[model samples]
Structures are given as structure tokens and as C-alpha cells.
Target: MDNSQTSILRRTVSSDTYKRLCSLWQQMAERKGQDSILLTEETLFSVNPSLAEKKYRERFCLLFSPEFRALLIGTLRTEDLLYQISIIWDTRTIADFVDRLSEESGQRTEIQCLRDRLQQILIAQPSNNPDLQCHFTLKLLDILTPETLGGLEQMYPRVSICKPVEDALRQQVTQERLLNQVITQIRQSLELPVILETAVKEVRSFLQVDRLVIYQFINESSAENERNHSSQSLGRVTYESRASDRIPSILNLTAEDDCFTYIPRYTEKYRRGLVVAIEDVEKAYSSSFCLVELLRQRDVKAKLIAPIVVEEKLWGLLIAHQCFETRQWFESEKNFLGQIGEHLAVAIYQAQLYAEVQQQKNTFEQRVIERTQELRDTLLAAQSAHQSKNEFLGNMSHELRTPLTSVIGLSGTLLHWSDRGSALSLAKQRQYIQMIQDSGKQLLELINEILDFAQLEAGKVLLNTKEFSLQNLSRQVLKNLQTEATNQQIHLELDCRVEPRHDRFYADPDRLQQILFHLLKNAIKFTPADGTVILRVWKENNYAVFQVEDTGIGISEDQLPLLFEKFQQLEKSRQRTHGGTGLGLALTKQLVELHRGTIEVESTVGKGSLFTVRLPNQSHRQLKTTPASKVEERVTFESKSIVLIERDEEVATLMCELLTAATYQVVWLIDSTTAIGQIELLCPSLAIVDRNIPDVYHISKTLKKLQTTKSIKILLLSDKITSTDWQSLSRKGIDDYLLKPIQPHLLLQRVSALVSSDQNSENDKMKL
Candidate 1:
């Protein structure tokens, strides 16, 4: 501590450095004690000669620098003296050597005792002031034994042992877990609106902000159901002391495109996952420009926005705001807001899933109801058809029986009086025969109509399509109706727009001819002697239009709609004179429609009527190839067993005669009651049983019982067969149906085909 050493120390510490050092020492001494003086460079050089030759000024400059001082005393406290001394000793050995010398002189006892006592005092002192702690650490280290310093190290406060810091961390973890639990419960228990409100309120409280809002993007193409349930508004007051009017409208600023527009850039720096943070609303340019202005007008300066991502997709935003000056948000606050946003995203996704499930349920219910109504309508239509058929049958039975009885009685009288002089004249006999023939024809036509209608209704009508000359078919119809037309003196005109020889077309020739014959017959029945019936044919588009125009007793407007309905005769009272089964036009229309064509009628009450038929002229290649002439001539019957099981004596007799003419060996039974026993005896090739016979089911069962008769072709003849009756027969394996009174030609044809086809099939089966 000489004058030269002092001058060297003074030169080492500049004016600014001296002032700073003096201030630090003065503060330390005031807080600690008057003996707590800083160790000068001269005292250090006196103990070590290498220090005296060294650059004192340069060395002192480093020691007094802010960086070095901060390292020595920044976080040091009275209890940290041993740690600071150890750090200072590591840089210089002179301090440690000096302390050892003092200890050897026996003068170290006084310093050591004082240091120990000061250590106790500092350890017991509460850590209220950081400066007092630093002062004690510097002073105590100057007096103590630098060796045997391990005891002093124990009193230092290491960062690892700070109880308050650990407690603070534990509290933060508990708060996060509790917050998470609350969010989960809120989402589960509440609807979207309630959940959103709760989330905003929680975020506002956690952030210590004035207000919070959840703004969701509105999809332009939202469904009707979504539009009704979507969140329209969500916000909450963070503080009860705050004014309600201070809660600015968040909607006025946010648009569909504003969310997540500027969020990605600062996500890494902040690490809080916010989309945008308006630290000062007035200074920053945001896409939410209007909203910023509104917020500023209401005195808001700071805001934190987090994007709501549902199902990993950005949905909208969660906005937390302050009404005062710009507030610096902490990392914890940002994290809390992010958690609220995440919970809200999940809630929104769940709500949407629930909505979808409900929509599907509603659609399924609507479909089921529609299907049920359709089935009901179809059942009603079937019931109506059944009732109409019953009425028709009743009316037909009376109409047919009256004519049949007269013909039979008249024929018997002629036969009985043939031997007497008063026998009927030849002219009268011929007239009676004609009456019988006419009545038979009428009955046959009625039976045919019923069969046709049944086939159409059952969806079993078959068309025999072929290429034929239209003119030739028309000529044939004219020839067949010439006698009737001549009797009525009605002129039948044929208008061939195309060449007669060039009028070739594809169609079901037999059905078409039948339709023409019926139309001509009707026209002749209603027309006067001088009236003309015209048949015209032409081509249009891809159809051939055939029109039958009749100058007859025309139909009225009220009667027109009923023209094509079954059993709907225009003149109920004059039905007999204009005799028909009233099914011709209906059958015609049905047949046309089956070909995917159409039939239409035009008429004026007193003038005339025109019936037009349009058939599709599909290309010949697309049409089914016509069967060979020989194949067409052959009728395929589905039965072969020939058991004549008729109940009516006269009808049975006629059937026997017809079968015999066809060379069919018949096993005749007068009643179906004994038919099954006879079928076993004869093992007949076919059984022709009357469906109306007594014990019909028993006969069917018995036939099924016989091994030989099990596969027999049983033809069921009836005056009429209903749908239920037909189904019953089908279930019992009845092969075919024949309506009576039977046509001799058709019967002979059916029997021949049935026997032949059965024989051929049996032969083939035996070979197999």
C-alpha cells in the first residue's frame, strides 16, 4: 500500500471506473458494515510479484467492467459467499495465498470467528433485499479461511433449491390440467352456442382481457339444416366492473377470408400459435380494417387472435381483446387461448357430425313413407279391378244364357217336327240354323275377349311379329267384313297413301288384323246404309300411322273418355243391337302399348270419329326374326293327358265329337266327381276337367296322388276364371286353361299339339 502502487491503481481505474467502483463499495458498506471495503490492486501486488510486473491498468479495466462485475454479483446473495469466493479464487491464486498466510500467523482466528459469526447472521437473515445479500457475500469471503470452504458452500442458494420457483411451476402444471378438464366437460355437456360462450368467457378470464369472441366462417353453400343451427353470435364480458357497451361487435370486422391470413409468419417466434396479434390496433394494417376501427373507436388497443381448427382444418377464429393501452401478452396467456380454440374446434366437429346423422335419418324416413303410400295405391287399384270383373261376369252370364237357351229350344223343335206334314219349311229351317250359328259366334267372341283381357292384365300377352304387306292384310279384313258391310249397304273405302304393293311393314299381323276387323265391325254396326267407313295408311317419322275413320253415329264428348275402357258400352240400352263384349278397343290399346306405340281417337259428336294407330317402325335388324311358316302354323300346347272330364252333358258331347275328329282317343267322364278314378284306370294322356265341377280340389288332389297322373297335363275349362282361381290352379300344377263354349277348330289344334309335344319330350327325357 505504497504511494507508487497507489498511483498505478489510480491510473488503472479511470475517472468513470473510479466513480462506479466507489458507488458500488459505498452501497455495499451501507447495506453490510464499515469494515466491508473493496480489496485494491496494490494489496494484491504486494503478495504476488508476477502481479506487480503485469499490466495493472489492463487487468483492472477487465475486473471493473460491467460484464465482469455482473458475473461476480448479479445473482449472488449473502448465503452465496463461498460460491463467489471459489469463482474468484479460480481466476487468481493470490487471494487464497493471502488467506493461508493470515491463518498461519494466528491472527486468522479473529477474522475466522468474525466470519463464522457473520455467516450465522447472514444465513438467518430473510431474503428480502438482493443488495444486502450481495454485500454480505463479498465481506464474509474477505475474512474466512479460503481452505476448508466446503461448509460455507452449503449456505449458498443454488437455483435448484429455490422452493418458491418449484412451487410456481407445480401450480402452473395443475392449472393446465384443471383447465383441460373444464374444457372437456363444457364441450360434452353443452350445445355449440353454449360451448362457444363458455370458451370465450374462460379465455377472457385467463388472458385478463376485457372481452372475448368466437367468429366462425360461414360457408356460402351451407345446407338448410346447417343455416338454422350455425353460431351467429358469441361473446362475453371478462370483468363485471367493465361497461357492457364496451363490448364492441366482433362481426362488423371479420369476413370469410380474414381468418388465418397473416398467422403463419410469427407462429415460430411467439410459439403460442396465434393467427394475429394486434399489439396496437391504430398502427397495424389488418384485413379486419373496419373491425380495427370499431375497436379503436371503443378504446381497444391490444388483441390476440387464434385460429379455430376443426378436424385439422381451419374453421374460424377466437379473438381476445383489451380495452386500454397495448398489453404485452405472456407465453402462458397465449397457450391458454390456444387451448380454448382447440376445444372449440372439436366441439364444432361433433356438432356437425350429429347434424349429418339427423339428416340421413330424416331422408330414410321420407323414403319409407313414400314407398308405403305407393303400395297402398296399388292395392286399392287391384281391389277396384276385382270388383269390376265380378260385375261384368254377372251381366254376361244373363246375356249369354238367354240367347243360348232359345237356340237350343228352337233346334229341338225343328228336329221333332221333321216327320210331320206340318214340319217347318226349308226356308224357316235355314233361318233357325242361321240363328243358332249367329248366337254361337256372339258367344265365342265374348269368350275370346275375356281371355284376351285376362292375358293382358296378367302381363302375359305375346306378339307374333313378322314382315307382311299392310295392303294385303287390309284387303283380307275387307273381304271378311264385305258380307256384313254389304248387308248394311255401307261403303268401305281404302285410302292407300303409299303404293298398295309397296306397303310392306313389320308388325304382329294377326293382332293387327284382329284390331282392324273389330274397328270395321263397330263402324258397320253404327253407320247408316249410305255412310262410308275409310281405312287410311301413311308413314310419319319412324312410325306407320293407320287410321280408321267412320261416318257413323258418332260419340259424344262425355262418352269419349270411356271409349277404351273394358265393358264400357256407349249405349247401355242399345247394347244388344250393337252387340259386343265392349273389350275390343281396350284390347287394341293394350296391345299397341305393349309394342311401345300409341293409339289416339278424334271425333265430333254428330260428324264422325277417327281412330289412329301408331306403331314404331324399328329397323328390321333390331326386330326379332320371324319364325318359319311351318313353325308359326304349329301351335304349342302345354298339356297332353286326354281325360274328357266335362260336367255338362251337351258341352261334353260336343267336346267328344271335336276330340274324335282330331283322332284323339278320349276317356270320357260325365262328371268330374268320378274323373280321378277314371284317370287312374285309363292313365289318360291328358285330363280335360271342368273347373266348376263338384269336389274340384279333391279331383286335383287325387290326380296328384296317382303316380302316372302326377305329371299329367290337366286342362281346366271354365265359363270364367278369376285371378285367385287361376293362381290356385297354377299352384296345383294345372297345365292350361280353356274357356267354354269351345271352338271345334281351336280344340282340335290344341289337342294335336299337346299330344305331339308331350310324346317328343318324354322320348327325349327317356334318352337322357
Candidate 2:
């Protein structure tokens, strides 16, 4: 091409437009035989020299230059002709060269580019689209002249049919452009509101409708659970675009809106791609008065609807209304709306997926934060425990060495005096010996504390529970701590509020003594000179409460939580003043919990501290049982045979031996579970039940209820039973309620009398 051709092209169109087109043509022409095409050298150069040199491409980039737009139609042209064309080729142009130079190259691909953060929002690469396999149809009308359009004057003639071609091209281009804009919006933003709003406005303008809207249905689960439709709001107009204010806006109309109560019952059909088109509302809904009234009120004469189905569910509807005059429905228009609906579905699915991903990201971040904080807390606790144990190690070194030094130093002095043959005065020698004994005891106590803490931590300690008097134990504890309290110049007081009846609570007597001793010793040790340390004991129902209150330097509030932690000593400055192993309070708490009891403390910084311990009565677990012990193989006298339900080992053994020595079969049982079975097997005529058995009352009642044992006489023994209570005791199936201190001879006499009474009653029955 020469300057003349370029000049002619410039005169036909803008200089920038023709120059860019020429550049693209030259580039495509240079890639010869690289990709299959429907163009040949002879055919391209024969009809029009300019077009002959241009290679064909189905897709082309259309860029608007400022100079070009100013020369041609500028920004003021709002008609369809001014709209940009995305693809200038159609199917008609492909067939013209199908026989000449066509190949089976139908697969084409384009990668969708997006922002980094939104890269995962794509469904897939949109390659292999059937729309890309067409030929070029709309030629450059700008470059076409009357002489050139004739195409060398022989094969084609008068090719300048500009207006008809331009209109057809414009229409197709506008529809494609609208769809491209929707796709662009979907890619650019994740906000559903913005996408839908932009889509509705653009669609309404393109289709020339009075109203366009997106009606979103409420969640199906929520709608089904709701009883009030007014509050439920089944479906509402979420997005709307209107041409004029005269046509009433149904932008937010729901099922509760006036005349909007009717819901279209075509969901199933719509989900399967059904498009609804009503040419005229009155004619379509002739018998439906409510729908007609609704349409009339909105000034809507025609309506077209397409369903936006997402993941095979009818998510919402895309609706367009004609309000001015009655309109005819066209197949092309219906299909276009349906295509738009499909695109909207894709956008909806993408937006929902993006939202879900973002939520998951947020949840994962929150969990990370929580887990990080937990790890930090665990680290701090471990460090504090390590530090506390370290402090304990240092204190223990001092504690262990002091008693050891006293033992070594005092014994050395005693040996020196003895070797020198210079015996000291008896008083002086006794004083030295007493101090050595005291130091040894102190060392032993420290060793025992460490051993006890180790055993408790290892879960090796077991309770040896028995009945003990609380008052006796408290007196012993006070006596042990009395000397220490006097030495410290502290006043010690004991207030026992336990009633005589409840004073004998059940626990291990030795451990109970140890617990009270340690508590009182602690009180006396911590009390300042002339301070008062009081020990209070009381019974509250089944629990016995022990409180130790001291008017001494009390604990601070901040130190209370860790006061019972192992090897933790408080007020480090006073640690040297009040010297001992740090395991005292920790050991106390462990012992309390070991008995299924709780210990609590209340204190003020400089005022006083009260330590309260509540211990539950465990009398039922006090006894050690010997189930079915020493059952004889044979019975000589059926009436003389007896079953002994006793908990005390010595008492049961003595009773069993005595009855056997009298030539009577005997079964001794401590566990009540096996008492009835053994008695029935032995056919015992008498059952001696002890009050120490937990279910002794129930045992007697059950034995009397049985037919074989109903005639058997029960002998009840209890320490507290009196002669006056026999009437009340006999009514409970006991033929005799004997008081305890049962001598061998006395037990035998009562047994003989009770057996005779039963025998006499049986004899009376036989005679009757």
C-alpha cells in the first residue's frame, strides 16, 4: 500500500482508527501459516487491495482513541451505532471460505485476568466457548467506498449497504456489550448488591422497559418454619430500575405488600429454565382478579420473567415490566432475558463461594489467636511453677541442715566430755540431751512431711477410717501445740460445739490427730507474741466443721490462689522468721480433699486469717467387712443353727466360735449383700445382727418378710440400746433388743431364751 491508499483510508475514517487497524493487519499477516486461517493470497488481494492484505481474526480488540472519537461520533452519540463492538464476525462469513481454506481448528482459549486477592473466585477458564468459532461478518464501514465496495467491478456489485448492516450489527453488539458489562461487574466486585444493581439498571435500559427488578426469595428453611407470612417476608424486590416515577415502584414489595400477596407457583418449571412472558396482564390473568388489580395498580401492561437458578435451586427471579402500552412477546427477547438470568446465576454462585471462603479465613484467624493465647498462659504457669519449686529447694537445704548441724554439734560435745572423764552436772547434761532429742524429732518431722507429700502426689495414700471422738482428738491436738504456743507467748483457745451424740464422727483416728496437730501448730507458729489463736469445732448436719482463726499477720488476697500449691511459701521476707518446710498448707489441702472434704481460707492483709475445713461423715465406710466367713458344712439342730450379721471382726469371730462350741451350725457375715443367701442355705433359726452394719435396719426387715425366715428370732445388739426402748425395737421385727457388753454367758442365755420363744410360737401354730 502507498501514500495514496493511506490517504484514501484517512479520508474515509479517522487517521488514528485506520492506522491502528493497519498495524494489527500487518501483525496478523506476518504470522503466516502459524495458525490455520480461511484466507489465501489471491482471494485476499483480488477484490479489494486493502482488505486483501488483511488477515482474518474472529476476535479483535476495539480501542477508542480521543482523536478518533472526536473525528467520528464523539461522547454525545448515545445511540446503538455508537456502542462498541466486541466481536465483528458472525457465521455467514465463515461459510464463504469453508470450502477454500478451512481446517478443524474450533478450540480457542482466553485466560481471565483478575486481582491477586480475587484470583480464587473464578469458576474456571472460559475457553472452548462455542461463541468464539464464528467468522467475521460486520466489515469496517469506515474504510468502504463506492468504488471499492464494488469489489473489482465483476464478482460483486454495489456493496455499500451501510444503514441496514450497521443497525443489525449495532443490535447484536449492544446485547453482547450488556452481558460483558455484567461479567465485568461480577469479576470486579464481590458485593452482590452492587452487581445486581448495576445489572438491573443496564438491562432495563437495553430492553427499554419501564421497570426491572430482582426478586429474591427468602430461605426455604426459614420460610417453612415461619407461621406469619407478614413477618416472614417470603420474597422481596431487592434491586430495581425504573424509567419513570409515574409507574409505581415495587422496589421493596414482599408477600405482605399490598396486592403483592400472590406468589407465582412455577418454581419447579423456572428451575428448569422456563421463561414467563405475559403480552397483556388483563388478557393473561382474565379470571385472576387479584393479579390483574396488582398489575393495574402498578400501571404494568406486560411482564417478562426469567428465573435465576443457582446450584439447581431457584434463588430468585429477573423480571421486566412494560408499563406504557400493551407489548408483544418475542422469542429473541425471552431468550436474551434467560441468558441474562444464567449469567446472574454464575455471579450469584461466585459471590456466595467468595463469602464462605472469607468467613472460613476469619474463623481460622480467630482460632489461631485463641490458641496462641492459650500457649502463652501455659508457658507462664510452667515458669511460675518452676520458680516456686526452685525456691522450695533452697528453703529445704536450710531446713535439712539446721537439725543435722544440731545433732552433729551436740553429740560431738557429749563425746568430748565423756572422753575427758569430766562428766557435767546432771541438769546440764540432761538439758543438752533434751535439745538433741528435740532436734532429732524436728528433723524426722521434716522428712515425714516430704514423704507424705510424695505419697499423696503419687496417689498411694489410702484412708483407714474408724469411729473416733472429736473432742478427745481436739484435746490431744491442743496439748501438743500448748508448749509451742506458750513459748511463742500466744494465747491458745478451743471451743468445741459438737453435741455429745455427734462428737464420735467417723475418720482415721491417727490421721485426724495429725490434721489437727498440724493446723494448731501452724496457728501457733504464725501468731505474733501476745496474739490469740482460737480453734473452733462444730457439727452441721452430717459434716463436722473445723475452723482455725488467728489474730496474726494474715495472708494477702493476691497470694490466696497459690497458697495451697506445692512448695509455695508466701511473704518471702518473713520466710526466715517463721522457718519450716513449705509443704504444710499444701499437705493440709491434699489431706482434706483425700477424704472428699473441702478447705477454704479468708484473710485480710494485716488483720487476721481464718482457715475452715469441712469433713463429711463417712461412718458407713468405717467398717472392714468379712463376707460369709467360717460357714459350717453341716447343721445338726435346725433350730439351733444361726446366721451372724456383724461388722466387728473380733465380735463376729467370738460369736461364731461360741455357737459352734455349743454344737450349732454357724455362718458369720459382715457384708449385708450375702447375709440372706447364707441364712437361707443354712436354714438358721436365729440371726444375730450388729448395729455397726450400715443396713442393719433393712436387714432385719427383709429377713422377717421371707416365709422361711419369718419364724426366725432376730437378736439386735447396740451400745446405746436401753431397757425402755425394747417396745419400740420389738415392733421393728426384733424379738429382743439386748444392750452391748455382751458376755459369752450372757449372749448364750439370751440366744437360748429367744430360740425357745420362737419354738413355743411355732408349736402353738402347729397345735392350731
Candidate 3:
């Protein structure tokens, strides 16, 4: 052979038996044709006795059977013959071969050198290529570590270590180590499922087994001795071996139906417990049907089942099975599975606690919403009730005032008409007129109280601000009460720190006077016959103070708090004796407040009481004298078309007569209903209304609605008409308001002012 050809032959057959076979084949090929030369097992065995047993078995099968020879030759050319041969050989034969290689003095040094080279190649290769590293790693383990040999014997009893098998084993172990790290990280970082899953994958790869499952126990009923167990099964994983391209089946199992049998023992243990079963498919107990069925289908030979426990409760179980091969599980492996399961239990418990807290928060929020709605409803109801009370009071006041207006109006007419000589003697006529006047005054006072009370309730009481003399105001009040005091034989005294005429201040003069009048009148009404009333006025610290003291029946201590309440009579049975509405003091207090003043009362039982009124005083200009001509002109006679609407015929006639004497074209309507039509037809220059008419507001609204009565002046006459009522009537389009028992001169003045003002306003409108 040429040197180049010899070198090629030497490389192809470096081993002893291979070299002899190659030489024989070369000679045969040269003698005969290349086709005639055959590479046979006998030729290999003849040169190397070490290969004799393998060659004997191979040659016997190949020579006797043509099919076997063809198949062997075909497999050798296309596949790895060394690897295939190792796989087919028994584990004992391979182990013996490894042992012999270690003992032989001639090959020991060569083997050692090869082993070093293999390690260098493995270390040089990238870690990403697990198969290459695995091959070298297994080869080195076989050469250097007898412990590994023993372990492999126990782990894979029937298998032999060949190049490809060694590659797969190395890859699996490396993957298992990586997966174990991942499991540890998951346990440290996350909590349960992630750690369990990672651990299961690692174990599955290391053992070369399929069907790793995790089943969790759900306690359906938490009640003691009544706990029902349920299972949540995490399904299976499949494993593909390097020797076979086909994937083997892996199935998961859960003990949901037979939970009592499988879970009771684990619950009692309060720690990890394990079950290892071979041929679990044939087992009759119904611990886990899924596990059994899967094992049977995949031809599984062994399984390891471990419980997951947390805080003395059996949370779940992890099942790993070997499908294509039989495996013996170790104590360390079982313990690892239990630890992973424990992590899973803790995660589930935390999630449950979070859910419970969220539920309670939602419930509390719903209750708060309901309570808020209830409070809103109650507040609305209270507002509605208050509104109803105001309306009722307003209606009652209107009804009461109508009749009182007529009584006072007629009395005023009678007093005016009385002469020195009459149907009766002068003395008797004067006495009768005085009685009528007294009754009319009493009625008017009661009506005024009612009207004042109504105004306070409606929050419509307004003060008329003006500069007036406080001393003159007090004097005027005393002058008005002089006649009453004289008849009662009681001395009424006025005490002022400043001069009666010199004490000038700025305020609502009329409202202040009205409050003083009510207080004095209340003192007079409650005083006994011949009892004295004293009016005291003074100024202190920018405020004017007035005190009205009287010798009268005093208020009880218990009644003091309720003294200013509307319609509250101090002595219920004594109401008629006083001939006064209980609203006088109440109205007095409210009017004082309207003027930004305060009223206080101090009294003792069976002793006289004193009332004090303090008002903030502002400086006032000196009163200007009215011209004589202006005063006379204001009272001058004027002819006006006047309509008087009153409920009583006697009062209506008296009003008509008075207007007639004043040269007014008078139209009197006794019934208020007919007044609207009469006024509309007459189109009067002025209309006089008794506000005590039934449906008074409706009547007022109707009068306002009259189109024909444009620029027509209205004068509302009421025994109850005070400054507050006057303001309200003015807002309703009444030009002026007059109280019952009206003075002739004062009435004349208002009528003239209203008529002239109306004429001026109309002229302005025409110009516009």
C-alpha cells in the first residue's frame, strides 16, 4: 500500500481488533474484487481475544441469518455502532469492561490521558450545549468516580452507559441543578405554586420520569369535625428520552373522591408524608384514580407521592411517576418535594385572608351610605313641618283680624259722632262713647299682637330706620296712655336722665315706639286698679335704655323662660280679666331685636315686674318744623272716589259716612266678595280695604290683578296693622296702611299724600 493509503488505514483502525479486520479486508480486496471482500465479526475476534465474546454473539446471529447481517451492516454505516452496541449490551458487561480498563497496566496511562483531554473539551464548550458537556461529564465520571457508578446502578439498574446515554444523563443532571436553583429563588422571592412547579420540573428531569403533578386540598367546610376536603389537580408533564424520538405519556393524579383516605394521615402528621408505590396501576384503593389511569396508560412502574403541610394543615400533595422506566426514590428526594409543597400552602392562605378583608370593607361602606340617606330624609321632613306651621299661623291671623277691624272701625265712628247733646243726655252719651272706645282699643291691641306674631313667624318683620327723639317718643307713648291711667286712678310717671325733649337718637322711631307702647300697655293691663306704672329712660355706653316698671301681678320663675313665646298666656284663666292677647310681650321682644336692641324682664311672684329695653343709639339731626301751609294743605278737603270693603254693615256704613263728610265719592261694600266688582266698576280714585276679610291675601292678589284700577291707590285698614304689616302691604302694592280706630287728622294726611303721590307717578308713566 502507498504511504498515504497506509496512513488512512492506520487512522480508521487504531484499535487492535479493528486494525486486524482492516488488514484482512485489504488483502481480500486485493486478491478478489472489492465486492468479494467482507468485513465480518469472525475476522475481528480472530485478532483480539478481548472482543471474542461480542464478536461470537454478533457473528452467530449475522452468518446464520442474512436479514440480521444486512440490518447490522446497514445500521453500522448510518448510525453510531459503538453507542448502539453499548445500549444493547447488559449493564453488568459494560461495568466489567470499565473495571478491566481501570485495572490493565498497559492501557491505564492512555485512559488517564484520554480522560484529561475529555475534561478539557467539556470545560471549553459553552454551557448552552448541555448534550456535549453531559457526554464528557459521564465519561469522566465512569473513569474517575466509583461512587457515581454505584449511584447509577441504583438509579438505572437495567441500563448501560454509552456515549449518547451519558450525554443525556449529564444534560438532565445539569438541568436539575439549574431547576433546583430556580425553585430556591422562587421560594425566596414568590411563595408557593412557583416554587412547587420549579422543584417538580427539576426532580422530573433528574429521575428521567414523566407526569409530575401537584394536588391542593380545599377545605369545603371549616367547621370542626366537619371539614370536607376537595382537590385542585395540577396536570401532567411528558418526558422524551434521547434513545427514542417518540414522546411518552405523563398523567397527573388527585385524591378528590377518596380525599378522606389520603388526606387524614397527612393532616395528622402536621409534616411531610410520602407514599411510594410500584405498579400503582394495579392497586385497588381509590386514593387517586387519575394517577392510576395515567400510570396504566403510560406503563408506569413507580411513583413518589408527598404531602404539603402548613401550620398543621395538609394543604396538598405532589405526585411524580416513572412511566418508561422503574425508579427507586430516596429519602432526600422525598423531603425536597415536601418542602416545596409547604411554600405553596402559605401563598394560598395569604390570598384567602386578603379576600376576606376586602369583603368586610365593602360591607362597611354600604352601611355608611344607607345611614347618610336616612339623616338627609329626616332633615327634609323637619323643614317641611316648619313651613306648614308658618302657613297655618298666617291663615289664622287673617281670619281673626277681619271681624276685629269692623268692631274698631264702628267704634271710632261712634266716638267721632258723639256731641254735647244727643239721643241720650251728654253725660250718658259721653260714658257710652267712652265704653265703645275702650272696647275698640282693647280689640285693636289684640289684633295688633296677632299681626306682629304672624310677621315674626314669617321672618318678614322690617324696621323703619329714621332719626327721631327717644325722649319725645317716650312722651308720646305716655300721652297716649294718659286717659287709661287717669280712669284707673294710677299715676303714670316718666323719668328721663336726659331732658324729655333733648334726648334725640337715630333708630326705627315707629318700631321703637310700638315696642314701648306694648310694654306699657302690658304693664297697664296686668296692674290692679289704682296701680302705678313708671317709665324710665337713660343712655349708657352708646346705647339708650328704657325701663317700664309697674305694680302688677308678677310672673312665676318657671314661666320666665316661656314669657316671649307667641300665644303663651301666663295666666290662662286671667286672659279675659286682662283683655289682651298673649302675643304683646312676644311681639315686643321681636321688634326690639329688629332694631338691634335687647329686652329683659325681671319679676318676683306677688310683686311688680320691671322690663328693660336697650337700643344702640346713633346721632340724629334736629327735628325740622313743618310749614303751616304744608300741614294745612295736607289736611285740606279733597273729593275722591273711595270704596270701603268691610265685613260688618255697621262699620261699612260708618266708613261711608265719614268719607262722604270729607267730600269723597264713597262706595261701601259690606261683603268683601262684592268689593272686587264694585271697585272695578267704580274705578275709584282710592280704595279702603279691611285686611281681616276672609281670604285676605287672595283679595289683595285680586285687587292687584285689576287692569281697570291702574294707578288706583289702596289704603288697607286693620286693627292689626302695625309697622311690620304696613311694610308687607306696601310690597303687595298697597299705597298706605291705617290702623283701626284711626284718627281723623292722621287719616286725612295719608289720603292726601297717597293721592298726590299716585298723580305724580302716573304723570311720570305718561311721560315715559
Overall lDDT per candidate, in order of appearance: 0.60, 0.68, 0.57
Q: Count the clashes in each prediction.
A: 8, 2, 2
C-alpha lDDT (0 to 100) for residue 230 of candidate 3? 33
Candidate 1 stretches greater than 4 Å from native:
1-328, 353-361, 364-368, 419-423, 455-461, 475-496, 499-502, 519-535, 548-579, 601-610, 624-768
Residues 569-672, candidate 1: write the lDDT tens digits: 77654354655666788888887765556788888877788999888653343234323332221112112336787667768878887787665656678766
Backbone clash pairs in model 2 (N, Cα, C under 3 Å; residues 3+ apart or in different chains), count = 2
* Candidates in descending lDDT order: 2, 1, 3
TM-score winner between candidates 1 and 2 = 2
Model 2 Cα lDDT, one tens digit per residue, 408-452 = 998889889999999988898898889899999999999999999
Give the clash count for model 1.
8
TM-score of each: 0.45, 0.56, 0.31
* Poorest 10 consecutive residues by lDDT, candidate 3: 62-71
Model 2 lDDT-worst window of ten = 63-72
Question: Which candidate leads in TM-score?
Answer: 2
TM-score of 3: 0.31
